[model samples]
Target: MASLTLPRHTGFFSGSLPTRPTLRYAAPVKVRMSLSESGPSIAVVGVTGAVGQEFLSVLSDRDFPYRSIKMLASKRSAGRRLTFEGNEYVVEELTAESFGGVDIALFSAGGSISKEFGPIAAEKGTIVVDNSSAFRMDEKVPLVIPEVNPEAMHGIKLGTGKGALIANPNCSTIICLMAATPLHRHAKVLRMVVSTYQAASGAGAAAMEELEQQTREVLEGRPPTCKIFKQQYAFNIFSHNASVLSNGYNEEEMKMVKETRKIWNDKDVKVTATCIRVPVMRAHAESVNLQFESPLHEDTARDILKNAPGVVVIDDRKANHFPTPLEVSNKDDVAVGRIRQDLSQDGNKGLDIFVCGDQIRKGAALNAVQIAEMLL
Candidate 1:
């Protein structure tokens, strides 16, 4: 396993705009590499969605080495054209045969598609970095965040001698763990209570439009209709999604609890989460109260997070400086702030902190690409 050195520039593309293609993507060309540098052809499984778009952006922004790049999606999006490296690539309908010559496949489509076709892609000798909940808990599948669990990538054995699939953690889990994992290294994280302010993008592009449309209706004195959600998403927050299980917890909330435990590899670590769908467009924010086995002071906790990998400490209560969803919308580093001792607990053994990160980057596409980089 290799350790990732944190990059100096924390913002996505360091001021480069994804809406406008840079020189890096201005020409129809393949990256030339030596024999050792050369590997396999690359493919993006869900090339039409938000995360899929970010995958393309990161691949270009980081200048990843690949001989050829293929864009694959459902039949509905097959005719769409996407540009990368200054070249236009027509989207192709996803099929089992799509993995014939692909070396690496980054999957961000829903779990059902991954469960159905991910293995076929791997069997055809393609390394898959899946961003879904489908195979994340599978013992054979390695759920990875390059910054926190690069070692998990090593567990992905290429059985077909060409490719293997690696799972990306849930967006909420990824952002939360990036800030909490480093602290766990210093002190045992016995339990955590998190209330998340998740953006509509996490739900999908349609949810974002629903939020906008409903907001317009409400402001115009019209009754808001629920389509993407069970209730009004504009000027309102709902705690329900998909279904509520027998345990009295919603599926999304349960995912956060289980996924966090799996990522940390500590079943003893207790996590209670309230996952709420907010009207924000991009970033995800969390208010976390952590109880440690030993006493951890607020100052020391701040120091730990400030120096931790993949985390940026932005604590300045005097200046009202703290991370916001807008501040972290397009940033890669997880921003931590509002650090304080939890006085409700005895002996000040608990710590309270706030964190925010771009759900699409560290929480999704960028994290997967970073794992592939570590493997290289």
Candidate 2:
């Protein structure tokens, strides 16, 4: 993959990350998205990370508002320069005291960083929209997907000095629900089996670079680099790298099972998933088999999704066209295809569908930002 050519920074903004004055990105030739001025006081936690950078892009793309904004990361990332919306801002080290008077904090750091500072920021009256697994299952926190269940975080708002936490569901869960939820609203889903083909972006930017580097090394007849994953990732697919639990499911797979029940707000729903890591650069694809309590014909399900928000259908049998990760990269909508009735089930109660979505955008950054938008 070719690297993006970005403008060189001229200077840096220093001192504790400010929250009152508006910050702007350095001007670049690329078309810039409009920025909203009526938004809350926002902070992007883990600003040095891949997902953290994505948070800024999504915010700009949506023209999300902010009274002020802060760029925060680990100590090592401190003093680094990041340009956004034509303004250059310095990355500041995150600390417990970082969330004073902040209205919303979008957190994408590793679970450890979110685990440590998430609640602290919330205590400081910041609404923490965490993009990690640390608090998804927490009984107190409302796990949310804005398109699917905005009601989950109902009554949470900005300007209330008191803290609140909202957990962003796993990327796979978010993409799956985007298509499945519409159909489910028409006919209740009783059980679902999921098989995912996740891309390298799920592992972060370094892993993406490693995949590209390894592909080159392999093409050059040299040993592939194995820094990110234990095995060679070039031209290969493997079971997800997440740790396997005692229940015979890896953590990633289990997240789909657990998160679905929570997001759907149906404790009785049965879900099983098998997640795999593929060589794709971005977006995630899943094969989902759903058995509904009532018969949901393929045509009716298709119509429901046709009117659904944040979903695009690409199922065209004549052209043999369907949703693919490459097609959905950088797109906000999750694409659904391969919509058909399941033959194995007794009746039309069971159906199978394939879904594809950009893991970095809709799956992570956009979802978090949408949650923040509801607060305003």
Candidate 3:
């Protein structure tokens, strides 16, 4: 119920209506509100996207504390309806004014939209849990994984006129680090060499459809056209998404490298990643080789991972069992298996591990919602 003054800037207004203003707060203040009695009023931006849909599902499944909910999307998706908590809510067009009186806003739209509107939502005294890359690297914004950094939310000011925006890490980075961070605590993670097999869902709804349609055409003995992807996505793998930087790493790969270091707060830790898009619908699997500051045996490394939080160790060589994308799909916990020492390297200093996680849940939607829950 507190408001901050907006600076007079040309970009702050479109035509007649004053556009949302960017707000800055010295510190967060909590207003005396009974969330238990009335629940928190919440809004979801980009409600039509895959991650947005997952956000809705997670909120309902987890019974998040919310009194009311608003669904906002692009003009094309406006008037569409989604059911939640046994009630239907119509999607509204996203605009500067859409976040009025919203207690919390979950953003899953592209980075540009998040950049333009996220600050506006924060100015209106709404806490934003953003699932985009826009604010992840911002020093002021907290990139959080609830299992690893719930304490990071302690610094967030909910209602004191400060726009609290927390960023969720990239899907690949989130899944990989969820399995690796805990192990780093016991043995200092000196370097990480990782390759990712990502699902089509990571690209978005259209990419998923493209993979499906292309697969169908190939099975029917027809020519398959690639649109959502630069090349055929059905029964194929591609190493390109966005563009490859001068360093030969694609944007997706670089995101994993940079984000991993930040999340672990270990700049000295070395990380290299190769991200590939596979034809799977959901879940992402990673093959990781880690070099530790202190030498750790395979059994000891496996024990640390087995007892790690948000991790399920599924290593069983005799039964030929290990974490797979299909098995970990739709699951929240990161699955780790195929634990071994990298004999290719001298000494038992390096460990090899495989991890699988639902890129939609633990990677994006569920993680953002969990951060919100931690704040509550």
**Residue 83 error for model 2, in Å?**
1.4
lDDT of each: 0.78, 0.85, 0.79
Tens digits of per-residue lDDT, candidate 1, 1-376, equal 1111211111211123223211121212233232234754788988777688778767766677877888887987776655466556778889988988777899998999999889999888888899988898898888887778777776554334666778999898889888888777777889999899998878765676677678778989999878888888888776746588898887777877888777777888999988888887678999999998888888888998988888999999889999998888767799999999988988768889999998887899899888877766
- Local accuracy of candidate 3 as per-residue lDDT tens digits, 1-376: 1111211211111123233323211111212222245677889898777788777667766778777788888987776655455555677889999988888899999999999999999988889999999999998888899877766677675556566889999999988888888878877889999999999888776776676678879989988888888787888888958688998889998988888877887788899998888888778999999998877888998888888888999999999999988787667799999999989766778899999998888999899888878766
Q: Identify the leading candidate in terms of lDDT.
A: 2
lDDT at 344, model 1 = 94
TM-score of 2: 0.91
Model 1 alpha-carbon miss at residue 322, Å: 1.2
Quote each prediction's TM-score: 0.88, 0.91, 0.89
Candidate 3: stretches off by over 4 Å: 1-36
Better of 2 and 3 by lDDT: 2
Instruction: Tell me the deviation in Å of residue 349 in model 2.
Output: 1.0
Instruction: Provide the clash count, candidate 1.
Output: 4
- The deviation in Å at residue 303 for candidate 3 is 1.8
Show model 2 residue runs off by greater than 4 Å.
1-38
Sorted by TM-score (best first), the order is: 2, 3, 1
Worst lDDT run of 10 residues, candidate 1, spans 1-10
